[model samples]
Target chain A: MKRLKKVGLIAVVCLSLVACQGGVPKEALELSPESLQQRQTQTRRFDTNNEAKLLTSGAQVLQDLGFTVEDSETKLGMIAASKDRDATETGQVVGAILLAILTKQAQAIDDKQKISVSLITRPISAKETLVRVTFQRVVWNTRGQVSKTEPLDDPKLYQDFFAKLSESVFLTANEI
Target chain B: MTNTVKKTACAALVVLLLAGCQTDSRDQVLATSESQVALRSIQSRVFDTTDKAKTQRTIIATLQDLGFVIDKADATLGTVSATKLNGYAMRMTVSVRDHGTKQTLVRASAQYNQTAIEDPLPYQQFFTALEKAMFLTAHDAD
Candidate 1:
């Protein structure tokens, strides 16, 4: 009986303690941009070769497909160009040019992830360009097997990831 | 004798009640702290990709298509750093790392508040949308 009484007493004490605490902490779940930037700066090591390789390969591919490759050497994975003289016709031609490249690359990757290749042309206040057709390619890779997959095994995922990157810049260069 | 005994019992009861309340509060706080830790563990797993570089490349492409030039971009285990071009009102960043290796898929979410967002410009929007798109890419959009 005495032991039972002691245990009961302990239980009561525990409950009382819980009722006194305050609300959530001010910075409990929030992240500041600075912290984010710091973390990235600390971790992200840039490889000029990686960026350069991708850019060169992309430009070469674009030229092989017959689109004029402006700025053979682009900095920081960016390429820009003025709009083609025959805007819509040129856009269609570029899209077709990209389609052939994408089809071949997608087959090579044998990827199962969904690839979203979007083309949007937002006006640059330069001229009669209704929309600047900027291309983007994305693959979900839900299995999250990107870094895990070898360049040979899931070449499509890697290829697609870079395909859009290269093509997006490819189009931008035309617009510049 | 009876009045004195009653007063002592009442005082003792108050002391016991207060102590019980204190213990309860302590346990709750401890439990909450533990849960928060667990949540963070889960969140980190959101970025558990075998290759973060490949993931970032795909996301960057999508962002470019959406008309936002990536300003500052980086990637790690389950996280990405990116800024939209022209200083658009949206910023896109996400952590795809989560804790559990084989159990829960999402590791950590940098864009938890963006689960409900529909905009295509923000990183969250692009991230989630890309997730859906990735599913299709992986499956070959049959």
Candidate 2:
């Protein structure tokens, strides 16, 4: 019985140490001014003459990507849309919770993850328009609290959007 | 046997309590001087329209115009929150209160990531665009 008690004490100490571990990395949560500047400049610009045409194509691209348009203004050269996706399967959530209990490390499963897109179109010149797109992801745990937000920095994602926008612009111009 | 179990449980509880005492490092980031400046720069606006519902719709439209996704809008609470992505994540919250029969008070706060945005350019630009939206909304009504 004494031996069992010692083992239990050791286990408790180990569990407590593990539980004290931070879930998110320190770097992931902090943003410096220099990093912010670098990120701000990471935008895709499309060459087009008609702002209205660009807006229409941009809206279509968002729709094709499974985003629902929340608001759009042609004059303002802005379009906002969002898409919600399930981040974890039901089985994964159950397993994670069980593991969390044993490990004492909180395993936060963001069940509902949201991706929001904001597009801005501007006329650089009489015959040139520039389009910039920004994508943000909001992660929410099962408790519906925002866990984290990540700026989508994948270049390919931006390329894909621009490619579709280019196609839509061609189609729109052809229609005119 | 019971006493042994009780002592083990107590020790575990104490450890857990100590772990909880550790402060989250994220709080340190917000305490920085830059973050404080950003927090102090939040701005508000007032609208001439008396219709609260109409004002709310206009606010939603305005945020959408700026490429913000409306996260939550509560008419009863007179609050609306929206998020946008530039190079970073930006979240904006607008609170609307009825000033009187013909006026409404609107206050807007913006944050970049977890810290408040101290730059006036973004806020000014947003409110400027919002002014246009309000004009357009009024024009559409007529």
- The candidate that wins on DockQ is 2
lDDT of 2 by residue, B1-142 (tens): 5877977776766666655634676665545444544444436566778776656666765665455655666667777777865445677888777766766767677777655555555656666666775773221110
Q: Report DockQ per prediction, comma-separated.
A: 0.04, 0.08
Clashes of 2: 1
Residue pair clashes in candidate 2? B38-B118
What value does the lDDT take at residue A139 in candidate 1?
26
lDDT of 1 by residue, A34-115 (tens): 4333222211121222444444544554444344433221222433211222112445446656876878642112223211
Error of 1 at A82 (Å): 18
Give stretches of model 2 more than 4 Å off: A1-42, A89-108, A171-176, B1-90, B93-108, B111-142
